[model samples]
Each structure stands twice: as C-alpha cells, then as structure tokens.
Target: MGILKILIIVTNINTYAIGNLETGLWLSELTHLYHEAKEKGYEITIASPNGGNVPIDPESLKRFTLDEVSKQYWNDMSFRALLENSKSLNEVESESFDLVYLAGGHGTMYDFPDNETMQSIIRNQYEAGSMIGAICHGVGGLLNVKLSNGDYLIKDKKITGFNWFEESLAKRKKEVPFNLEAGLIERGSDYRKAFIPMTSNVVVDRNLITGQNPFSSKEMAKVIMRELGKLK
Candidate 1:
C-alpha cells in the first residue's frame, strides 16, 4: 500500500494578559499520534485555527510527565518544524488526507468548536470515506461539525471525552470553556465514560474514535491505525 496521509488539527489560543504563554496542543497527545503515524509510513499535515507557531502547555513537557519517546519527538528538528509551519484551517483541503485526528489541550475549548474551516474539513473527509478521531478535549472540536444530510456528525454515535467527574476532580471545573460530556449528550450522542480518576479509556464507534484523556493517546492512535489498515 502507499503512504497514509494524516492530518492533525489543533487549536490556537491567545490569552490577552498572559503575554506569549497561551496553550495550544498537548505534547503527549501530539507525540502519540505523530510517532505512531510515522512508524507506519504515514505523512502528517498539522493544521490549526490560526496556524503559524502553535503553543504548548509548558507543564506537559516536564521530565516527570512525558516518556522518552515524547521528549525526543518534541525536540526533533523536523518535527519541531511541522509545529512551526502548521497549515491554517483555511489552508487544508479535505482531499489531502486519509484520516483526520484532533489533538487536545485546554486551549481547544475556545477555538475548535466554532471553526467553520475545521467543520468543513471534517464533513468533506467523512463524505469521502476517511476516518475521524479525537481524544479528551479534542472531541470538543466535533461539537458543531455537521453532515450534508443536516445531522450532527456525532449524533447517535458512541463517544467519550473529558468527563464531568474528571473536570470536577481537576478542580478546574469553572475554568473549562464548556461541559464536554454534557454537550455530547445534548447533541444526541451516546456519551459513555470510564469511572473517576480519569484512567486510560477509549471509545471507538465505527469510524469515530474518542479517547478519554492524554494518557490514552498512544492507544488511541494504535486503534486508528488498526481501523485504517482494515479499510486498506
């Protein structure tokens, strides 16, 4: 088979008073997807709401949190370049990828939901028979994407994301832009989640794959790879 073309969509956040400290994609999540896809000879195209240099949560890069693979991937010259030169949402065309994955972080809540460019990319990919996957707050991006038939793309599908209980436990309840689990249910999706403590959890429904948190990104990408290979 030929190379797999994968598109990773991230958020671009800018806090008015924080200087350049705004957060974008979580490093662990991107590390998971990037390495897994690269090992399988997949070409990656990263896009964001505003594109250009995307920011990352500095805390996520600390030595205690990330594994060696993640640490190495983050510092690689070529990989770093991809993050620096990401395509803007408006620059992505649906026909370019075989799969589209949404990487999550706190910043996603603000931009991913209402990005018309992203919604169009999802619609076009699904219509063209490509796989769609999101993890944690990344699923927030799918909240408003609709199909040509006038139905929410996630409607009636079994999906999972950062749960309400987890949010409460994080003590960041109010800081969250919106309630992810509740929003999924409100849209008629079968929102299911694992118990508290936010353990490793992943939900795959047909072509849609949703992982509960950054901890599940590796497994999530593996699942996506398996599903895409099956199609081939």
Candidate 2:
C-alpha cells in the first residue's frame, strides 16, 4: 500500500473565551496520535485555521498530564518549532490527505467550527472517501459540517467528544462556549460516552471517527491507523 497522508489541525487561540483560563491544543492528543500515525509511515501535516504558532493548553503541560510522548515533544526544539509555524489550512488541498484529524483543545471551540475552510475540508475530504478523525473538543469542528445532501455529517451518526462532565472535572465548564455533547445530540447524532469518566472512549460512524477526551487519544489513534490500513 502507498503511504497515506494525514492533516492534523491544531489551534491558534492561546487562551479561553473567559478570563485567564488558558487553553489550546492538548499536548498528548497531538503527540500520541502523531506517533501512532508516523509509525505506520503516514505522511503527516500539522496545520491551523490561521496558521503559525499553535498553542498548548497550559494545564495540559502540568505535571499530571505529562506522558512520555507529550513530555518528549514538549522539550524537543524541532517539535516546538513545528507548532510555531504550522501550515495554513487554506493552503492545502483537502484531496491530498487520506485523513483530516482535528486535535482537541478548548481553543478549537473558538476557531474550528466556524472556519469555512475547515468545514470545506471536512465536508469535501469526507465526501471524497477520506477518513475524518477528531478528539475531545476538536470534535467541535464537526458540529456544523454539512453533507452534500444537505444533512449534517454527524446527523444520526454515532459520535462522542469532550462532554460536560469532563469539562466540569477539568474545571472549565464555564469557559467552554457550549456543551459539546448536547450540541452533538441536538444535531441528531447518536452520541455516546464512557460509563466511567475520563476513560478511552472512541466511536466510529462510517468514515467519521471521534474520541471522547484527551485520555482517548491512544486508543483512537490505533483505531484510526487500523481503519485507514483497511482502506488501503
């Protein structure tokens, strides 16, 4: 099989909508997924809606959240540089990638959903038979994506994202713009969650793949690799 290409979209907003609640890309979400896809020899492109200088949620860089993958990349100057200079989403042709992955963070809620280019990429790439993967708040990007038939991409499709409870646990319930879980259901998605909170919960609906939270990164990445391999 030929090497597949994946577009990993991160966030440019370095802070939350409210006060000083800093939020951006969750480090583990990007690191874990990137490692999994890279090991499979997939061509990866790190990009952003506005491009240049992707931010990391400060909380995610705390001692509690530091994992081997995130920790390694956090300290790697080259990796840091990648985040500093991400490609503009508009510059890339959606057809060039086999998968478009939205990496989760509170910042995504601010930009991913409303960006026409993002919706275009998600809608177009998905319609063209490419896989669409998103984790945590990154699933915010899926909220407004419409299909060619004039239906929501997630309408009646099984999906999950950063839920209200997890947001409460993260002490960010007030800062997040809206309830992601509620929004998904309102959009007619068959939303599901892990019985136990903060566990790896991933769901697949056709070419759409989503993870419930930051903890769901590793499991979801494996699922993405397996599914993409099947496509090849």
Candidate 3:
C-alpha cells in the first residue's frame, strides 16, 4: 500500500462576537491520531479555514494532554511544519487525500458549519471512497454534506459528539455555538451516546465515525483504520 494521505481539518474564527473564540484543534486528538497513523507510515496534512499555525485550546490540552505525546509532538519538525503550513480550506481538493480527519475545538462551531469549500471537499472525498472521521465538535462539518443522491451524507447514520451533558459538566454549556448532539438530531442524525459522565465514549456507524471527547480520539482512529482495511 502507498502512503495514506490524511487531511486534518481545524477551525478558524468568524467573528469576535461575545462568547465566541478561536479554539485550537484538540491536542489529544491530533497526537493520538498522528502517532498511530505515523506508525503505519501514513502521510498527513493539516488544513484550517485560513491555514498556517493552527491554534490549540490550551485548556483542552491541559485536561487531555499527555506529557510524552506533547513532548514528541513538539519535537518533530516535520509535523510542526505541517501545522504551520496547513492548506486553507479553499486550497484543498477532495482527491488529494485518502482520509479526512476533522479535529474538534470550540472554534469549529463558528467555521465548519457552512463553508462551501469544505462541503465540496467532503463530497469529493466521500464519493472518492476516502475514510472520514470526526471527534467532538468536529462533526459540525457533516451537518450539511450532500451525497451523490443529494441527501445529507450523515442522515440516519448513528453518530455521537460532545453532548450537552458533558458541556454542562464542563461549565461551558452556554458558551458553545450550538448543542452538537441536538444539532445532529435536528439534521436527522441517529445520534447515540453512553450513560452519564460520558468519559471515553465513542461510536462507529459504518463509514461515519465519531467520538464523544478528546479521550475517545485514539479509539476512534483505530476504528477508522480498521474500517479502511476492511474496505480493501
């Protein structure tokens, strides 16, 4: 097999409106996925709405970060360079990658929802048979993707993201752009989640993969890689 070109999407802010901020891609999500896929020799590229030095939520990194991964990640020049030179949403084409992994952060709610460029990239990647995965708020991108039949790609597919309950526990319930689980349901997603406290929970529904939080990133990637293998 050749190198697996993975496209990672981060967030960009739209407005400095009250309570809205530019949160960086979740470090745990990126580190977990990067290390696992790098071990397999996959080539990864980072992309954001504007591209260039993706911001990271320092708070999420504190709660989700590990010292080892953080150290190794910061030490890698190539990986750091990729982050610094990520393509802008408009610069990315669907056929350029074999997989697309959407990383979640508070900023995603402001940018991922209605970008025409992102939607096009998603449609092309999905139609071209690429593996698509998202974690936490990253699921925002799929809210409006249409398939070849002109149907919402995630419609009726079982998925999960950062639930409102978790948001409440974190005390940032009212700060988010929208309730992700509710929004997914509003768009006809068959969203499912485990019981209370929802730590380390993940759901894999066909080619649509999702995780409840940063803790679920690695497991989600494992599921995605497994599904990719089965695709052959």
lDDT winner between 1 and 2, please give it.
2
Better of 2 and 3 by TM-score: 2
What is the number of residue pairs that collide in model 1?
0
State the lDDT of candidate 1 residue by residue for 43-160, as single tens digits. 8888898889877866578777677778998879888888888889887863568889999887888888998989999988887888899998889999999999999999999999
Rank list by lDDT? 2, 1, 3
Q: In model 1, what lDDT does residue 198 have?
A: 65
Model 3, position 160: C-alpha lDDT score: 85
lDDT of 3 by residue, 53-162 (tens): 67767665563465467557867887777777778977776357878888887778878888888888888887777778888889888898888898998888888888
Query: What does the lDDT come to for candidate 2?
Result: 0.91
How does candidate 2 fare on TM-score? 0.97
How do all the candidates rank in terms of TM-score, highest first?
A: 2, 1, 3
- Taken over the whole model, the C-alpha lDDT of each candidate is 0.84, 0.91, 0.77
Of models 1 and 3, which has the larger lDDT? 1
User: CA shift at 34, candidate 2, in angstroms?
Assistant: 0.5
Model 2 per-residue lDDT tens digits across residues 141-183: 9999998899999999999998889888988888888899899
Over 4 Å off in model 1, which ranges? Answer: 14-22
